[model samples]
Target: MNSFNEEISSKLGLIRNTLSETGASAVRLRGTDWFAWATAGASNAVLLAAETGVAEVVVTAQAAWILTDEIEAERLQDEELPGTEDSANPLYKLYINLWADSAARESFIRDVTAGGKILSDRPTGDEAPLPSSLVKQKRVLIPCELERYRQVGRLASEAMTEVLSNAQPTWTEYQLAGASAQALWSRGLHPALTLVAGERRLPLYRHATPKEEPLGRAAMLVFCARGYGLYANLTRFVFFGSSQANAEIRNYASGHRHIREIEAEALNFCLPDKPLNGVYDVLDRAYHQHGYPQAIRQHHQGGTTGYLSREIIVNPSSSQTLAENMAIAWNPSLPGAKIEDTFIILKDGRLENLTFDPKWPSVKVEGRDRPVPLEID
Candidate 1:
């Protein structure tokens, strides 16, 4: 079998194993993230804002199927499900109904499962919710998925570099956001989230949404770029003034260095088989050691990321453990200063940064090159 087919077959094996473990006969996935992951990058999302998608995927031990309304079935079959037109060997059997016929859709789902116990990612009615452990099986990406993730990460970083390198001191936050969105779209990536904070707003909001405020002397550009069902997150900063001349700019730079130190510590703690909360404790202590004891509480340190922007958000109370082959995106933030990058824990337990751009200004921290603010002077 081709690599793509092998990838799908491996995922199906995982689903079947989950069914055997959970005592369920079939599994239904309705979340947009789940749909993309199970289908090896086919998108089911029509409304980008919604968590659930227009189509659903059902996997039984014997076969798999895609169920959607007639409005979407044709396009999905023709475009998304490649090699599915062959009658002798199809990736997934299509089960479609008219968009307006809710009753018919429900009846079809019932008949397909033959009244067996059903498990769903987003449960409704008598279906049981899929276990979190089963859901997390998507975290360990196969070879093909990792290659696509690398491509997405490279495109995302290139977009960030292009947009921020041309930024001006007079541009408004909205303008910056627009340029960022355009950059990602031009590279065939969707800007799942774009946050631009100008100098005046940077210190005021942690999750700063773009606004009309003009960038006075400094700004932060953050992007969560999505492509092929994977997310690559990165944050870059720009300063227009001389750090030595302005005390505020100097302080911002100083805080950025401290945050970088915290981030470096967090990255170093990401080892296979380590408790995720152990890394959280490392961040908490790193912040305290750097004289910002309260910074850890100001924002959530990011966690595993793949199909979703964040598959898990790490906290002091988190129970999950870091594992090999899992992708991680950790964002350690203080007001006005935050650092984030997507990384993967390789099979050998080494952390590889997926969003590294050699052209971006960086400083060596703990023997690793970490991003620093780009000064335009």
Candidate 2:
């Protein structure tokens, strides 16, 4: 079997076991994150604009079904579901439960509901929280997922760096965002989340989306690229004009001593068996130690990332523990300064920097090398 099919089979087994543990006989996967996890990369069925959550995949002990409209179902069956037709096809039982009629949809739901307890990510009538334990299971990267994350991270970093570096001071934040999105799309990755902030917007807004305001002297571009049913998030900065024009931004970058220290320590605390709250504790101390005690309160320090932008965010009150082979994106930001990257914690207690790009300029901050804002004349 191909790796993709293998992943589907393994995931089905895991899902069945999880459901059985919770006394649920079936599960209806609706959200993009959960659906992506089950199919192991099939995402063409998701229709974001429609509120109906039109596409759903229901899985039970013996079978799985993909419920969708005729058009989408046919397209997926033909182009995306690259599996054999024989009954022995590992994925042969994954039928596209098409809804050519309203009665058919109702019948599918009824049949599954009769099987036993049905859990759902997008619960409607009677479903429980998608087992928090399942989140931990999904966050841990499989081998194929690890390779896909690395590839996506590299491409995303390159796209962000190239687009932001080529941006002119006269360009507006929207224009910069446009260029960045185009770069990512050119590489066959969706620009799932794009945030662009300029010199005027940075210090004030932490998660600013692009605006018509010009980039002026400096700007920050953050991109979360989605492809292969995986996500890679990155941020890049650019400054324009002469040395003096760049000095203010340089000072802003330098002022991140506290944030950088917190970031590094948080990564260090990402060792196995360590709870996510421990990492948050280190961040809190580093923030207060550097005299920005309230900084962490302003935004979320990012968390484990893979199938979702943040599978499970780390907060001061969180109780989730770090696990081996987990991909993490710890983005600790304070005012005008922020440091962020995606890394994987291995079983051997080593952190692999997935988003590292040597072509991007770097600065040794808090004794660790990090991407520095690019300065252009």
> For model 1, what is the error of residue 239's alpha carbon versus the real structure, in angstroms, after optimal superposition?
0.6
Model 2 misplaced regions, further than 4 Å: 44-54, 83-87, 90-103, 113-115, 243-247, 364-368
Instruction: Show pairs that collide, candidate 2.
Output: none
lDDT of each: 0.88, 0.78
**lDDT of model number 1:** 0.88
Q: Which candidate's TM-score is highest?
A: 1
Local distance difference test, candidate 2? 0.78
lDDT of each residue in 303-377, candidate 1, tens digit only:
999999998899877889888879999889887888999998987767778898989999899887799999988
Which candidate has the highest lDDT of all? 1
Which segments of candidate 1 are over 4 A away from where they belong? 83-86
Task: For model 1, give the 10-residue run with minimal summed lDDT.
Answer: 82-91
**Cα-based lDDT at residue 217, candidate 1:** 95
What lDDT score goes with residue 207 in model 1? 92
